[model samples]
Structures are given as C-alpha cells and as structure tokens.
Target: MTTAQIIYEQYKVLPKRIRQELKLLINSEDEAEKPFSLMEDIEQGLNEVKLIRKGKLPRRTFADLKREMNDAK
Candidate 1:
C-alpha cells in the first residue's frame, strides 16, 4: 500500500470531532492541499466567520478602503 493509503486509513480511525479540529488547524489558502483535505480550510474559515459574526473584529469592505486612502492624501 502507498503512504497516502496508510494515512487515509489512519484518518479514518480518528473521531469525527478530532478529525474536524485537525482540519481546522491545518487550514491554508492553497488548493493544492485541498484534494488531500477540504475540511481543514473550511474549519478555520468557520472560525473567521464566527468572529466576524460576533462583531469583535472590523469587517472588511471595498468602500472602507477607498475612504481610508482618500483621507490619507
């Protein structure tokens, strides 16, 4: 069996919640790793989404950026 097959078998043994959390920790922007793992990026993204939902962090907007640039000049 290939290394990938082994890893797949190991991952299959993980508890659903733990596997999900591991995915979150490994999140990245590159899709190259996506075929290997989609749940990873999604889990991290979910946290970002939740933070924005809570209003604790400033939400991003195109108009806000324009206004800031204009003010700087």
Candidate 2:
C-alpha cells in the first residue's frame, strides 16, 4: 500500500485524544509553513510584474480591481 494509506490506517487506530493532538500538531506545522508559502506568492507576483513590463500579460488598474471587488460584494 501507499505511504498515505499506511498513515491513514495508523491514524484510524489512534484514540480520540491522540487524534486531537495529531490534528493540533498538523495545524501548527501548517502555520509554520505559511510564511514560506507567502514568500512563494510574492515571488509569483514579482514574476507577473516582469511579464506585465514585457507586455506579455495585460495589466489592470486599481479602479478595475476595486470595481470587481464591489461587484462581488
């Protein structure tokens, strides 16, 4: 079986309290990784800026974004 299947099988046998603790641990790990994920997003935005500067991608005005957000609301 796959590693995920093995892990799921093991997790299934865990007691309720242990499962809750595991969930907390998993959430904290996600929290720790968030800053790195934000940096990745910033890098992606910088790449998009380069594309916009080269005229490979269309750029939108802040007013256009504001209008879109208001429409969504």
Candidate 3:
C-alpha cells in the first residue's frame, strides 16, 4: 500500500479522542511551518503591541532602529 494508505490504516486503529488530538497536532505543526498570512501578521503585530504596552518589549523609535541597522553593517 501507499504511504497515505498505510498511515490511514494506522490512524483508523486510534481511539476517537486520540484521532482528534493527532489531527490537531498535525494541523498545528503544518500551520507553524507556513509563511505568515497577512491576517496572521496583523494579529502578531497586535500581540506585540500588547507586550509593548505591558513593558515586556523594548520600544524602539524609528531613528533608533535606523542607527542600529547602520551600526550592524
């Protein structure tokens, strides 16, 4: 049998909760490897803002970032 058929056969033997958990684990892993979508980027940025607001992320001004970039060269 093909690899997919083999996997499906194995998956069929898993209990319902185990199957659901496995599906979630696989899907989350797949999503983690994908390039960020626009909406995902926006949400990430929003999360960063929350961190900044809570003083968890260092706030850098545009000039500070530009100077840092120049210094890195």
Candidate 4:
C-alpha cells in the first residue's frame, strides 16, 4: 500500500476528537498549497498595495469589531 493508505488506516483508528483535530491539520496543510476564493481577496489586497508603494489594506479596529457585535445582537 502507499504511504497515504497506511496513514489513512492509522487515522481511522483514532478517537473522534483526535480525528477531527487531525482533519483540521491536514486541511490547513492542504490549504497552504491550494488556491481558494478567499485567497483571491488576499491577492487583490497585494495588487492594491503594488499600485501605491506605501498603501496598505485597512485593518478592523477593536472598537469596530465591538460595535459590529453589539449591532448583531
């Protein structure tokens, strides 16, 4: 069997919570190498910065997050 098959066999025997954690780890590794729609936003921000050497995307302030939470309730 391949190494992945061996690992899959080992993973199948793990506890539910352990399996979930392992799944997350595997997903994160996969995400790092894969392109997704969310990454397009990141790439757009990078492109925006290139247009103006000193420009950067605005970050959400803590107060803004707090206000948003309050509004949601």
Candidate that scores best on lDDT: 3
Tens digit per residue, CA lDDT, model 2, 12-45:
9999999999999999999887665788889999
Candidate 1: residue 61 Cα off by (Å): 43
Q: lDDT for each of the candidates?
A: 0.83, 0.94, 0.96, 0.84
Stretches of candidate 4 exceeding 4 Å from the true structure: 34-73
| Per-model RMSD to reference | 13.7, 11.1, 8.4, 10.1
* Regions of candidate 3 where Cα sits further than 4 Å from its true position: 36-73
> What C-alpha lDDT, on a 0 to 100 scale, does residue 67 get in candidate 3?
100
Error of 4 at 57 (Å): 20
Checking candidate 3 for backbone clashes, the offending pairs are none
lDDT of 4 by residue, 1-73 (tens): 9999999999899999999998899899998987668889899867876765655555557899899999999
- Tally clashing residue pairs in candidate 4: 0
Top candidate, metric TM-score: 2
TM-scores across all candidates?
0.36, 0.48, 0.46, 0.40
Q: Which window of 10 residues has the lowest lDDT sum in candidate 2?
A: 31-40
TM-score of 2: 0.48
Q: Which prediction has more favorable lDDT, 3 or 4?
A: 3
